[model samples]
Target: MSRKRVAEPGPLSEHVPGRKKACWGILTSQGSWADRSPLHEAASQGRLLALRTLLAQGYHTNIVTIDHVSPLHEACLSGHVACVRALINAGANVNAATIDGATPLYNCCASGSAACMELLLQNGAHTHTTHAHFPSALHEACKRGYSQCVESLLSHGADPDYGVAHLGSALYMSCLHRHTECSRILLHSGAKVNVGRDSDSPLHAAVRQDSADQASVLLDYGADVYLRDSNNQRAVELAPPGGKTHQLLLTFEVAPRTLCQLCRLHIRTVIGPSRLKQLPVLPLPSLLTHYLEYT
Candidate 1:
C-alpha cells in the first residue's frame, strides 16, 4: 500500500471565518486553532456539565490548540464518553488529527478506551490512517495490550498487518510488549506471522521478551522460527540459552505436529484469517466449532 501523505483536509471556513487554513501538515477546514479554551479544559477534565454549558453557549466543537488537537481528542484520550459524545454531537471532527497525526480514534486506542472507540467509530472516525508515518490506531491498541480496542478496530477494518518502519507490525508490538491476548488476537485476525520491522518476525519479538506462551502461540499460527532479523539472528538466537522461551522455540523446531494440531492449522489456513469470524455461524457441529475456538 502506498504511504502517501493523507490528502490535505478541506477548510472549516463555515465554522469560523477569521481562521487560517486547516493544518496538520495541511488542511481540514474553517475551525479555529486558537489557544486552549474552557471547552478544552472541560472536555479533558471530564466535566460534562461544563462542556454542555460551553457548547450551549456556542463554543465551537472543533476549536483546537496550536497543534490542531480538538476537544474531541482530549475527551477520547481521557475516556470521557459523555464529553466525547457531546463534542461530536456539537460537530467536533471525528477525524481531526494533531500535528503529530493522532486522531481521536488513535487516542481512544492509546487510552484503552473501548467505550470511546465505539462512540467515535459510530461517529465516522476513520480507522485506516491517511498519514504514512504515525502509528495506526490498531498499532496503538496492540502496543498498550488493549485487547478490546484491538478487537473493535479489527472489526471496523483496521489492517491487521499495517506496519511502521520503526514500530514493526502491530503483532510485533504486541509480542514484544508481552501482551499475550493481543498477540493471539492479531494472529487469529490473520496478521502475517512473519511480518515485523525490517526482517524481525513476531516470533523474534516473543523470544526477545522471554515470553514462552507468546512464542508457542506464534508457532501455532505458523510463525517462522528460522526467520532472521537485521542482524541475521534467528528468534532462538535472541533468547537466553536454556530459558523457557529458548527451550520452547527449540521444542517447536523438533516436535512433529500432532494430528489434531495439524488439522486445526489446516482448517484455519484454508478458512483464511479474514473469514475466521464465520466459524460460529457455519453449519459445523458444536463439537467442531468448540475445538476450533480453542485457538
Candidate 2:
C-alpha cells in the first residue's frame, strides 16, 4: 500500500478577497500582497509559528510598523518570551531600535518585565543604548521601582552610571525618583554618588524632593553635601522648613546663609549715626533694634 499524503487546509473559504486576512496570527493582507508585512503585530501577539513561517517565507525579519517599531521591540514590550526567542533565532536584530533609538531592553524595562528583560539580555539585546526619552534599562527600572529588573540588569554588567539627555546617569535617575534600595544597589555597584547635573548633586535632588532618607543615603554614599544649584541654593536651602530634613541638616554642620548677617550690618550702618561716629559696631540683635528706634 502507498503512503497517503495529508493536505493542509487552504485559506478559509469565507475570507473576503482584498480584505484583511489573518496570516501567522496577524490580521493583514496576504504575504504576496502589495502592502507591508505585519511582523510587529505577529510578534506582539506571541504568534510564534506565524513569525517563524514569515521568516521562512523570506519576509523581512525587521519589518517595522507604522510607528517604525521593530518586531523584536514588540515582542519585548508585550512580554512574549516565545516570540522573542523565535525572532532572535530568525536573525532579528536584538538591538534594533525604533526611530527614537529605543532597544528591546528599553521596552522590557519600561514594562517592568524581568522575564522579558532576561530573555533580551541572554539574546544580546543592547542595554547601553538609550532612547531619546530614556537612556538605559537601569534608568527605566529604577524609575519604576523594579528592583528585580534592576538587579538583573546589574548582574548582566549593565552600568548603573548610564546617563541620558544630559540629566546624568542611572544613579541620577534613582536618586531623583527616590528609589532608595535601587539607589543603594547602584551606589554599591560603583555608581557615582555625586554625579552632578547643572551644578547640582544627587544630594541636591534628594533635598529638592524633601526626602531626608534619600539625602542621607546619598550623603552616606559620598554625595557632596554642600553642592549648589544654578540659583546658588545649596542642599540645605532646598530642604523643607521645620521638617526632619531641617533637623537633619544640623547633623551635617552646614552653615546657614550669610545674607541675613549682611542685611543686619547694612541696617546698623544706616540707622546708628552716633554709633557709626564712635566706631564700627557689631550688629547684635539688641544693637540693631536700638538703632531702629533711635533713627
Give the C-alpha lDDT of model 1.
0.83
- Model 2, residue 261: displacement in angstroms? 34
Clashing pairs in 2: none
What TM-score do all the candidates reach, one by one? 0.86, 0.68
Report lDDT per candidate.
0.83, 0.69
Show where candidate 1 strays beyond 4 Å: 1-32
The most accurate candidate by lDDT is 1
**Backbone clash tally (model 2):** 0
Clash counts for the predictions, in order: 7, 0
Taking the tens digit of each residue's C-alpha lDDT, what string does model 1 give over 1-295?
1112334456456767566564343223554444566787899899999999989987778877767777888898889999998888888899888878889999998889999999989879888787778658888888889999999988887788888877989999998899999988888787888888888788888888899999888888777777888899999889999899888877878985689987987787788877877899999999998777663
Which pairs of residues clash in candidate 1, taking residues 3 or more apart in a chain or in different chains?
Answer: 9-27, 10-28, 11-29, 11-30, 12-29, 12-30, 13-30
- lDDT for 264 (candidate 2): 42
